[model samples]
Target: MTCSACHQGLPADARFCPACGTPAAPGAGRPVPAAPGLPLPEDKRKPVTVLFCDMVGSTALSGALDPETLRTLTLRWFGLMSAEIEARGGTPEKFIGDAVMAVFGVPHVHEDDARRALAAALGIREALKRFNAELERTLGLRIGIRIGVNTGQVVAGSDATARQALVSGETVNVAARLEQNAGPGEILIGPQTLSAAGPTVAVEEAGPLALKGKTDRVPAYRLLALGADDPELLRRFDIAFVGRRTELARLAEETHAARRGTRLLHLAGEAGTGKTRLLREWRTRATGPGHLVHGAGRCRGYGDHGSLAPLADAVRTVLAEAPRSADGHQDDIALGVLAAGLLDDGTPNVPLEEMCAALATVLARTARTCRPVLVLDDWHWAPPPLVRAVELLHIRLGDAPVLLVCAGRPGGAAPPATAIPLRLEGLDRAEAARLAADLIGAPRTPVAARLLERAEGNPLYLEQLLLPADAGTPALPDDELPPTLQALLGARIGALDPAERFVLDIACVVGREFDPAELARLAATAPGTAAPPDGDEPPTVLPVLQRLRRRRLVEPVGTGPRSPYRFAGGLVQEVAYASLSKRTKAERHEQAARLPSVTQAGDAAVGGHLERACRLR
Candidate 1:
C-alpha cells in the first residue's frame, strides 16, 4: 500500500503515513510503523487525563446529508473541538470518524492537568452550543456531543515526532468507554479525574459502571458546572490559619508603605506552600477605611489568554468596586475599555502603552481618594509584555497610593528589582501538627502524627491527606497517599527536561539522599544512557542536579561539592520513584549496589539493593 497524499510506501496495516502523518483510509485503525533501523520514541508512563468526545446520532445525521456535506460538517466540528482542547493546554490526539480523543499532561504536564481537561470539556460543550446555533441557521441542522474524561496511568508515545495518536492502555480504553456510556449532551468523568480536579469542580455521582474489558465496576461522576467557590477562600474559612505571623506582619508593613508611596511585593513558594492563602489573609487585613479599592486576579495555566489577562481581571475588579464618579461617566467608559482590551479574544483596541497609560490614570485617580491594592496571582506565568506594561505603569504612577502584589510558585519570572520578595517555606512542625489536629479533630493521635510526618509542613499536602477522613474514610494507610496529591507532585516531576528527569530518576533509586559524586557516577554508568556532551570533563549530571535544586525539587544536605542532596520532601521522592519504569528501577538499583558508598556501607546494603533489583526484574 501507499500514502495517497505523499506517495510514500506504507504498510497495509498502517493507520498514519510515516512520511507525512496523513491518516490512512477510513477504518484503518492500526498505528503507523517506524522506519527500519530507527528506534521508536520511548514510551512514557505517567498520569494523564484523557477526554473523549463523540457526536451523537452521527449515522442518522450522515444519512440526511450527502457525503461531501457530512465530511465538511465533521471537519468543522473537529476544528472547533480541537481549538477548545488546545486552548486548555491539551493535545487533540486524534479524530476517529466523528469522535475526538484528547489528552492532557503529555509532552508537558501541568500540576492541574486534570482540571485543565475538565475545563476543556466544559469549553467544548459551550462551543458546541454556538456551533449548533450557526448550523441551525445555515444548514437547518444541529448536533449534540457526549464527552467522557478520565485520569489515570497511560503509556504515551508517538510513532514519530509529528502530531499523532499517542496514548494507550486501560486509561484510554476506559475514557472511550465512558463516552459511549454517556447520554447525548452529557459529560461523564471517572472518579480519579474528579478527585484530581479538586473541589472547584461540581459533580454528581453517576454510580458504578460495568465497562467492557474490565472485571470490576468503575465509579463515575456526571460533571456539573465548575464551582464558583474560590479554593483559597475555602482554605481560609475552613482550615485554621496557623503560622506565618511574621509573613503577615511583613505584608502589613508593605501595605503601610504603600499608603505613603508605591509598593511592590512578590510572594514565592513551591506548590501547596500556602502562597495564595497568605495573599488572601493579607488582602483581608489590608482592606479598610484607608484602602478603598482592592482587586485580585489569577493567571490560568490554560488558554491563549493574552499576557495581560491577570491585569485585566484586576482592572475589572477595580472598575466594579471603584465608586462611580458622580460626573465621571467618561472615566467609567475609559476603565471599561481598558478592562475589555485585556481580554484574551483579540488584541487590545489601543496600543499597549496607551492601555498602560489609561490603567495608570485610573489607579492614580483611585489612589487620590483611597489606596488601591492590586494583587496579581501567578506572576510566574506573566509574559514579558505584561511585565513591561506593569513596570511602565509603576513608573507612571509616580508614588500614587497603590500597592501591587504578586504570588506564584518559585523559580518563575522574577519581580522587578525594586520589589520586596518574601519566600514561604513549609509550616514548622508545631504549626503542621496543629493544622492536622484541627482537620482530623484529634490531637496527638497516631493518625495525626503520621499525617504531619508525611505532609512535611506543606499546608496543601496536609489538607489533601485529610480529605479521605473528611469523606468518612478515617483510616490513614501508610502505603496509600491520596491520588490528588500524587497527581500534583507527579506533574511537577514530569515537567523536567529529559536529561534532568533521567538524573532525578537515578537519584530516586539511590535513596532519598545521595552524594553528588555518587549520582554522577551512576548517571555515567547507567545502561543505554545518552553520552555526555563531547569534551565535557566531569559528567553533566551535576549541572542538571543544580537546575533541579533551583526548581526546589531537591536541596543540599550541607555545603560543598561533596555534600549530599536530598529530595525536598518525602512525597516528592515517592512520586519521582513511582514514575520510573520497573526495568529502569531495577537497572538503577543494581547500578547503585556497585557504587563505592554502597560497598563501604557493607555487604548487607549491597545485598539489599541487588535483592530488590532482582525482585523487580
Candidate 2:
C-alpha cells in the first residue's frame, strides 16, 4: 500500500506511514511495520508543551454552509493553523473535527519549546484574523478560534523520522480541557506553561478554575501578548546577583584596557551557569562610568536571522545613542547606510569585507570620544560570516577604543587567538548557599542545604528549586529534578546521535564514574545496541565517548584508552537515566550485576545493581 498524503510505499499491514506519519484507511490500527533499514519505534517519557486549538461555533457554521463548502473551509483552517505551528518548531499532531492538537519538544526537542508553543499559539490567533478577513470577503462570514497551551510530562512514542501525535498523558488532556473552557478568540494557558515560557509573556490571572478530571483548582492565565524577543526581558532583574566578584573585576579591567586599544573577551560556561546574568551585572557597572558606549545583541538558536544578527544588534544599539559624524553630510549618510544594512536582515547586500570595514569605521568613529563596548550573547550560534566579521573587526580596529565580549556555552566556536578567555564554573559552596537563602527570603535551612548539595553551586538550578517555596507550594521531593532543568538537559542529550545516546545511557547505569571496559561490556548486551557500520565487530565505545566529550556532556576522569569517564554534571547523569523506561533500566542493571567482580568494592557494586534491578522489576 501507499500513503495518500505523501505517496510513500508501505508494508501490507502498516497502519501508519513511517515516512509521513499518515494514518492508513479506516480501522487500520496496527503499528507501522518496520521496513528494511528502518529503526523500530521507541517510547519514552518526556516533558512536552501541548497546544489545543479549536474553531469556535463550528456547528453553527456547518449548519449555515453546504457540505462541500464546509469541507473546503475546514481544510483552509487546518492549513493556516498547521503552517503557523510548524513554522514555530511545533509538530501538528492531528486534527479532530474542527479542533487541532499539536506538540512541541518531541521527535526533536529544543530548550525553548514552551516559548515556541506560546509563540505558535499567538501566531495562530493572528493568522485567523487575516483568514477571517478573507472569508468575510468571499463567504460573507467569519470564524473564530479558542486556544489553550499546557506543559507537563507525557509518554511520547513514535518512529524516529516521523512527526506525529505520539504523546499521551494528562498533559494532553489538560490542554484540551483548557481549550474547551476558553471563550471565543481567547487563549488560556496552564500555570506550568506560563512559568516555563519565562517572564517575557504578558499575561493576566484567569484565577483558579475547577478543571474537569482535576481534583484541585487549577490556576490558569489569559495570555495577552509576548514581549520583545530580547533575552534580557526573560531574566529576573530583581533577584540579587550573587558571587562572580572576580569575574566582574576582570570585566572592569577589560573596559579600562579598551580605552587604550581594542580588546576581545570570550566568556564561556555551561547552560544556566549565569553567563548572561554576569554579563548583565557587568553592563550595569560599566555603564555607570559615564564614558563608555555599550551595545548588546543576542544570537538565537532557532530562526537564525542571518550571520551578522548579533553584530547588527550591537551596531543598532550603539548607533541609537552614538553622536553623528562631525565630518560632513557624506560621512553622516555613509554611517546611516551602514546602520541600515546591519539592521536589515543581517544578510549583507555588500561584500562581507566591505561590511566589516564599514562597521569598523563606524565603531572607530564612535570610539573617538567614548569607549565603545559591543557585547555578543550566545556566540556559539554565530554563523561563519559573523565569526569572520568579528575577526576582521579585530584586525581593522587595532588601537581603537573598542571592547568586544562574546559569551556562550563551552565547546562552541573558538575565539580569536588574541581574545582573552574566561570560563565560568558553578559558584562556591558559600555563595551557592547564600544565593539560595536570598531567593528563599530566609536564612539557611535543611531544605536549602539539600538544594545546594543537589544544585552543586549552579545558581539557576538553585533558583528553580526554590521557585516553589516562593509561591507557597510544597517543596519538591528529594529525588525529583525540576521540570525546567529536565527540559534543558534533556534537549542536550536528545540532540546526540542514536549510538552516542545508547553509550551515554549505559554510562548512566554504570554510575557517575565508570571504566570504559565495563561500559563496553554493558553496551555489548544492552538492548537496541546497533552493530558497527562495517559489521565486523561489536560497536566501539571510545569514538562515541570522545564525541560526547566534545559536546561537553561527559569528560575524562584520567588519561588512557581505559581511562574512567564521568558525565559533565550530576544533573546530566540523572536526566539521561530518567530518559530510560523502567524496564530498560531494570534490564541494564540486571546485566550489570553479572559483570566479573574485580575487587571487594566491585562485588558490592554488583550486589547494588542486582538490588536496584530487583526493586525496579
Number of the top-ranking candidate, with lDDT as the measure:
2
Q: What is the per-residue lDDT of model 2 for residues 1-617, given as tens digits with 9 covering 90 to 100?
A: 33433223355567775543455675333334332222342577778999999999998999999999999999999999998887766889889899999999876666778889998999999999899999999999999999999998888863444556578999998899999889899999988887777778898878577888999887888999987755557555466888899999989888888877899989998877899889888878874443677788887665527668788888788867876556633346556657567678776768888877777887887876567789999876655567778888888899998999989876545565567899899999988887787777775553446667779888778877776632412356778776688888887777665566778887898888877777776776666644345644444578778889998889999877667898878888988888877788899889877766423477777788988989989
Q: Rate the local accuracy (lDDT) of all candidates.
A: 0.75, 0.77
How many clashing pairs does model 2 include?
A: 0
Model 1 agreement with the true structure over 161-207: per-residue lDDT tens digits:
34764778898998999998999999999887877776778888785
TM-score of every model? Answer: 0.85, 0.86
TM-score of 2: 0.86
Report the poorest 10 consecutive residues by lDDT, candidate 2.
30-39
Best by TM-score: 2
